[model samples]
Target: MPELYERIAERFGELILNCPPDRWEDPSPCPGWTAWDVVAHVISNHRRAIAGLDGSGYSAPGRGEDLPRAWDAASEAIKAALRDPVKARTLLGEEFGSMPFEEFVRRMACADTLIHGWDLARATGQDEGLDSEAVAVATEILLPEDRDIRMPQAFGAKVPSAADADARTRLLNFLGRQV
Candidate 1:
């Protein structure tokens, strides 16, 4: 799972670097959010995970031309935090009460990174599909029985996909993305 986190982070870094400057303002699948806003949202989630691990509040740095550098720094910080077994084991929030550190990293941090990586990729016209392993892991961890209830708030209503859709397409459709 730690490896998965690293892979997702690396892929996201690539997507960020590959994004054209002019496309930052392009609209994404996330309602009104732009491509840049999707990146910011990913950064925010990483900051929140770090804060949860350390019991410290985290805020995103101001958006600027140096956003890539800032994002890389935040991404590295998150990877580093996940590497520390002791810190990773610390219980930090109510939603994840009693869940072990590694589980939280796998289910929360990595899942968000994977999903949002797809979001950013799609927004930037870089959609080349997602890692199959990551999709499988996400399907197991993120898609709970009550997902139908919770997803509508964070994602659009589920879009239809082929009966034999691939894992990536299934994930995207399940998350309310019309891939």
Candidate 2:
């Protein structure tokens, strides 16, 4: 079976490709951010992670108002980095810092992409679907025992807990998202 991170990366990419350009103008679940803004955030994350892999410092240059262009730039940079052979395996901070290059890439880029995919869907009034295997992997990766709670404080609210929820729900909740 493919690793969870790989599956998530694939699913996230699919979500991005399928997003309707018209809906990019709509507001998403993320407060004060439009669908385009969310996409920009995801793409920016990809760019930063790829930069880390390339031995360059991560950069999250804020995109003031032109979020669509920001998204396009970040996305293209990340896509190019994905084709590179470098691996970023250092732990600069508490997030996925200690993970392997590929795993770090997935946890940071792919999982966020999955969540933002939901944000975009909500903004666009479309169905939200995460790759089941990817969610499961993320759930395991973000278990409370292994979780660093501080990270979500900087990103967004953690995923809310659900009784009898599957791995996906648990993972989403752990990440401070409401599923």
Candidate 3:
């Protein structure tokens, strides 16, 4: 079975693949970002993680490559990195502050993908439900570090949600997402 991060990436990839070509330019939940920008951001996140492994930064989509293909290339690279024992053990820098690559990828990358996956789905009028296990894991991992994640450059301020809201809703609300 695929690990949570891989599964989350795969789920996100499915959304990118199924998206109608015309919808690529549609504005997504992220203010001022298009559906294509969402994919590029996810790929950029992957490149950041990859940089920890080998100092390579974000590579924009090639002239012949669409967003989906670019996403596929990024997804495969990150998965391969995590699968390699040596690469998974590499240390992250900067915002991650020297955490092992696997831990950062599992918690941070996985959560990023999970939330952005919902953004894409919502923007494109697809199913917005997220994986229950991924949601639970994200809640468990992020809720404790609430203050750290609440900065304007990151998830920013929380949006209100009913106390009775489900796990996913609460996570979304906490991550500065209205839904």
Q: Give the higher-lDDT candidate: 2 or 3.
A: 3
Local lDDT at 169 for model 2: 65
Residue 21 of model 1 has an lDDT of 77
Model 2, span 1-179: residue lDDT tens = 22444455555555556677677678877767887777777766776665655556655546464554555565556545445545333343344365555566566654577777777777876777777766665555556544445453234556567688876666666655666
**Rank order by TM-score, top first?**
1, 3, 2
lDDT order, best first, reads 3, 1, 2
Q: What TM-score goes with each of the models? A: 0.89, 0.66, 0.89
Where model 3 places Cα greater than 4 Å from the true spot, the runs are: 60-65
Cα lDDT, all candidates: 0.77, 0.61, 0.82
Please provide, for model 3 over 1-179, each residue's C-alpha lDDT reduced to its tens digit, 9 standing for 90 to 100. 13888789888989998998888879988878788878788888787778767876656554356777778878888889888988888887876778888888878554788888998998898899898899998998898999888665477588999979998999999888888
After aligning candidate 1 to the native by TM-score, how far in Å is the CA of 151 from where it should be?
5.4
After superposing candidate 1 on the true structure, give the runs of residues whose Cα lies further than 4 Å from its correct spot.
95-98, 148-153
Worst lDDT run of 10 residues, candidate 1, spans: 145-154
RMSD of each: 2.0, 4.4, 2.2
